[model samples]
Target: MFEIERRLYDEGHRFVACIDEVGRGCLFGDVVACAIILPQRYTIDGVRDSKKLSPSKREKLNGYILHDSIAVGLGRITPAVIDRVNIKEATRLAMKQALDNLTDKDGKRIIPSYVLIDAERIQTDIPQLGVIDGDNIVHGISAASIVAKVFRDSLCISWDKAYSGYDIAGNKGYGTAKHIQALLEIGPAELHRKSFISKIMEGKK
Candidate 1:
């Protein structure tokens, strides 16, 4: 994983942003994306795909990534936006927003000379490469994944307070069996993606 990023560094790309997203498969809430730029050749131990890590582990890694990263930015697209533009475009939009948010403490924009995205081609003037399963194998993408996962999970926890039965916090908005049962019993909440639940509702009726 480090070797891939190291090669990019050797090629003179000083700032290489590794991008990844979370909640794309969720039945509620927003899709979140994160862009993380690490110092050249910097490697953090035990960093891997957020999906493979426990919640506690991811929370801890999130702190380390934020502290050690050269630049980190996050983006989120609401359920409304996802329904309006569709999930794929919404995801790309979030990625662009993440890139746009990259800046230093002085507020000067820190644009990446190169971008490494996880299996998604984004429209950007800056050069970018899309690698399949990059989050599992690429250190920087894994870091970004952890940030996105942890941030989105935190939001779900807050939402769970208002919307109790769906277990939004536990399932993180994924359409688990428990979540689907709640949706059937109570119909969709304001936060639920209507389009996503429509088919399930149809089946019930």
Candidate 2:
């Protein structure tokens, strides 16, 4: 269903990277993009979108991908930029940055001949295919998704320490009952997306 598979182009059995991203839906924190290329022999069972898997499973795969995959690169777009340019464009920029950092399995900095990218069209001059369910359909993309999610989750947990009252640790920077309640009680912090929660507390003001 994608050019990555349509061509069957073998770039001499190096690494065919599949790229994916997460955290775009979060009202707080940065949007993260991760790109990973795995060797042909490398395989992980039951890999799918990070959202579908348990937190434990995602962490396990993080280890697997780190040890087995080729170059794994993470890119983050900050909250300030997301506020200024919007999430869609920020996500695009992050994804592009992640892809631009890909390297071959042989440890050389080179573009993959074919790429399977989840959702967004990777802004690169390389031959790539954007698959709607790429993370579920492709193993490499699933790896990237797990890597990005784990990294972002850890970052959110860390932020919870510095920025109290947001419940970012429990909510992982997402809008949840605890998170919304915190906002109602104490209001938003610098990291919180002001536009997202203003409606919930509109009547209070």
Largest TM-score belongs to which candidate? 1
Instruction: Name every residue pair that clashes in candidate 2.
Output: none
Name the regions of candidate 1 deviating beyond 4 angstroms: none
Displacement of residue 33 (Cα, Å) in model 2 is 0.8
True lDDT of residue 18, candidate 1: 93
TM-score of 1: 0.96
Residue 197 CA error for candidate 2 (Å)? Answer: 2.8
lDDT of each: 0.91, 0.79
Model 1 over residues 28-129: C-alpha lDDT tens digits? 999999998999989888899999999999999899989888888889999999998999999999998998898755667799999999999888999998
C-alpha RMSD of each candidate structure in angstroms: 1.1, 2.7
| Counted clashes in each candidate structure | 0, 0
